[model samples]
Target: MADARAANERRVRRLEQMKTNGSAGAASGTLKAFWHGGRKPAHIVVRSALLKRVEGGNILTRLVLPRGVALRFYLLALFEAQCRLAVGGQWENVLPLSGPGSWSDMIASDGAYDGKSGTYMRGTRGGRAAEDLRLRQVQGALRTLEEVGGERPDQALVEVPRGPRGQRLYPSFRLLQESGRGSHQSPDIYTVPTDHWHPSRTVTIPAAFFLNGWVQVLSPSEVATWLALRVLSKWAPEKHQESGVFLYGDARKQQFGLRRDAWEDGCQRLLNFGLIRFARPMKDGDPAVPPTPNSWLMDFDQPEPRERYEPHRYQVIDEGLDQDAVRVCHRELTLRQHALDRRAAEVQSRKNGGPQQDVWPQWDGGEREMRFEEV
Candidate 1:
């Protein structure tokens, strides 16, 4: 354990050095300029089809990165590349004027900034670390996209650029070029005009998500939850708009492959972020009104309500991102996490028979009966 701890400390020190030095160089200025360009696009288009479940299941499940940052970065890059393709850019070629620095900078500027350190955080490390972590994450995402084909040769969504000798190239990258290769290929392939509307095939992520630092403030699960909610809101059935989309069953949750805890936690965070609101009328304490057909309260008076489940009617709030809201959500989540930890500890203590007693019952002759006394 001592050796392991020492090694970890060494690694951290190196990362800190990288962070300090990288920020002081010309590369840093270039990154900032590239990301903060006045002419940069205002919104990013994500292919919803990528989120859809295929035979191999959700692509997110295969991602090596812990947070949703990798997924976000991959989608952003894909959008840019597709736009290029739509405008008659060459397929199966290196992205024009694109390299590791710009790629990593885009993601870091959006998701890796550390408010406390006043520098971009690296990887899953909360404190200072090397900007190369973002590059590695980008590579990992691309690798995952390429390897998602698994045993099926034609299922890969990307074909990473390689040298003539099949050696890996550090800077060059390319999406799958063949017109009809991957069975699970994203609908984002360049075929028609990029500006054409395809409501069912795409989801537009507001530029505010990046510009307002929402990525830095929210967790991976929370980010995924918000995106999933957006997709649902877009596809929700007509007339259900008043109450929002129903997300009650395990089947519904499984569609996105998000575990129950993660999904619930994400929903709670989104609620705290003021990005979403639940519309359960019955739980509002109005006794006169009848519960909706989907409400769990409909069986409230029953002795046993078959199975218990929280009925959710999620409404995605379309509003500008707020810094105050993000700060409040962070504070609320921290407090709630502490409370949950305390409750878990208490339960564990009870299960372990906390504070075993040393006293035992002893007979008292004077009392003429068995009496309890300290042993």
Candidate 2:
């Protein structure tokens, strides 16, 4: 375990070094200016309508359930590509043409141009296998996106049926329109409407998501979870507090169709990656255990402890990718693990007819002091 941790630390240090060194290059300098101006992180704007549940289900929910992290990434890439092109005017109707090279560039990796083959090749230690797998994933994701909208043409349009009394219906509302089948060589064209009626309702994705070595590390489910939380923050700004955004009830499941286990795992991983933190410790009352043998039991069997339903409040850390932030995240994760272990031990002890152990120590106020250094 210690070795693994050390290796991860070394990897992070290498990424930081690469970022520092690469900033001097002309291309990197250009990207740095366009992405974030070397200060605030660059952000991707996604239309809220894509996440909305129309008559034919939500596009994002469909992508989430199928474990479509790559697809989601592709969607983000499309938006990013469009945003870049929009600067040249024709922001609304123009469809940006993107190929594999454009898509792969969005992710941080070591790659070189193969002059002989006239293709860009990934420069990973895993060799050909890894490169092939990466290409396949990207291509597969593109195909899936095409199929998703292709099967239901009506999904791109909003239209109501004609009334029996000859009443007129409002004009159709178009959300997203796609053209041409995308491929590794020739990419597809996607158009998003920009009009007053269908105003742009967007969610801002932290630029670090693509630039800060996170895209390579975060799993598909983890990415989905992060995006879902961001969407929630935009949808219900009132729920935002200093502690974080409180996620309660079956809203995530009902709205996003994220399974309970998947959601939990995603959140756990995001926490581990230092991209997110729980606003508070999630503690619950112990379940009732079978009573031990007694004469007739004492006067008032302790009133059943009321079940506590503490919703998880999560704060997405946008900046502070320094070592201090990493250490704090590591400490919090360790504490959480210890608490889980203690809870399991207590449960087993009660089942074996042994005395329940004392409650684990709760998180202290010091966690509130957790801070990350802005890059």
Best candidate (score: TM-score): 1
In candidate 1, which residue ranges exceed 4 Å CA deviation?
1-42, 64-69, 78-101, 109-129, 176-199, 216-220, 237-241, 248-255, 280-310, 324-329, 348-375
Give a tens-digit lDDT track for model 2, residues 12-59: 443443343341132223333445532243455555555544445556
Clashes of each: 0, 0
Q: Give the per-residue lDDT of model 1 (tens digit) for 234-347.
A: 664342356665453433334665666666656765765667777645344322222233321122244433343335667876573644333444355444444444445566
Model 2: CA > 4 A from native: 1-41, 55-57, 65-69, 87-101, 105-133, 149-200, 236-238, 280-308, 320-375
**Compared to the true structure, candidate 2 yields what TM-score?**
0.51
Candidate 1 colliding pairs: none
- RMSD to the hidden true structure, all candidates: 13.1, 14.8
Worst 10 residues of 2 by lDDT: 291-300
